[model samples]
Target: MMLPGFPEAAPLAGLAGGLLIGLAAALMLLGAGRVTGVSGIVGRAFGINDSGMSWSSAWTFVIGLPLGAFLVATLKGGFEPEFVPLPLLAVAGVLVGFGARLGSGCTSGHGVCGVSRLSQRSLVATATFMIAGIATVAVMGAL
Candidate 1:
């Protein structure tokens, strides 16, 4: 099967984004001594569990997710991503949520923080994640 190719991958933008993410995650770890895991932060914000960070702080981090995106969109003259069908999007979201639960954290948590700490589990989990995403794209394209 011939899969749709994304020849427009923006390497510079991707590198900049990755560096920013690493810087943010590193600052969170060094300054706060907490992993900047979105799921963990958001869960704490909602009082799911008591973590080292304060509830307000956790919520602040959660809010930054969208605010940062908006800031980037504004600077980039608006962000336009390829739109997936709504139904497919919903299903993908559900699957992501389930995967997060099963994995104990979101990709940002394990992929960024955990891997940086040289965690064996995070390395395995990140590998599984990439594999799953590639497989999903392949299967969906085949359909």
Candidate 2:
């Protein structure tokens, strides 16, 4: 559904996506006994971190991420994704990777699973992420 001021906002779609993410996180935690942290999974997959998660499992999770998004986008008649230049995108990726490593976890781990479990570190990290995101939007808008 469209939001009042944000005419293109899809609340229903957002809700559905959130639910799916939560469900997936819950399943990962319950079934695999692990947090669905993408960064950690990637690190494990690449042999950068040995968190006891299997390489195959980590690869499966990483591959399923984009595969799931692509399936949904295709079902919805596809979408055009805008991107910054390659150099800028690469820089942003590096920055984000560094931040995630420094923070010990990314948004999915901290904001979703950790927060739900009432972890203090996750709460603070999620708050910090929100503030940073807001500041970034404000700065971009001002430019």
Candidate 3:
């Protein structure tokens, strides 16, 4: 449903998505005894790191992310999303990868799992992520 002040906001859809994400994260942790960390899983899938998880399993999870999105978009008759140029996307991806490595875990891992467990590092990392995101938006808007 649309939000009052935000014409394009779909609160129900967002809530449903959030619930699904939480359920998936919880299932991943309980069923596999692993945090749903995309970056680490991607690394493992690519043989960049050994995390005791099977390569095929990691790859399946990584692939499912976009596949799920595609399914949803298709079911909804698709949407036109404006994306930056390939070069900018490549640069952004590299920077995000570097940041995830430096931070020891990505948002899903630290923010969702670790924070749920009340880990200090995850709390700090999540705060840092939020702050950086806000600052980036402010700066970009000002430009």
Predictions in order: lDDT? 0.86, 0.90, 0.90
Please give the range of 10 consecutive residues that has the lowest summed lDDT in model 2. Answer: 1-10
lDDT of 2: 0.90
lDDT per residue, candidate 2, 1-143, as tens digits?
Answer: 55467636477778889999999999999998998888899989989897568999999988998999999889988989887899999999899899999999999999998899999999999999999999999999899
Candidate 1's TM-score reads 0.82
Clashing pairs in 2: none
lDDT of 1 by residue, 1-143 (tens): 33366435566678889999999999999899999888778778989766679988998998889998999888978877778999999998788777887898889999999998999988999999999889999999799
Every model's TM-score:
0.82, 0.90, 0.90
Alpha-carbon shift of residue 107 in model 2 (angstroms): 0.5
Q: Which wins on TM-score, candidate 1 or candidate 3? A: 3
Model 1 score (lDDT): 0.86
Worst 10 residues of 3 by lDDT: 1-10
lDDT: the better of candidates 1 and 3: 3
lDDT score for residue 72 of model 1: 84
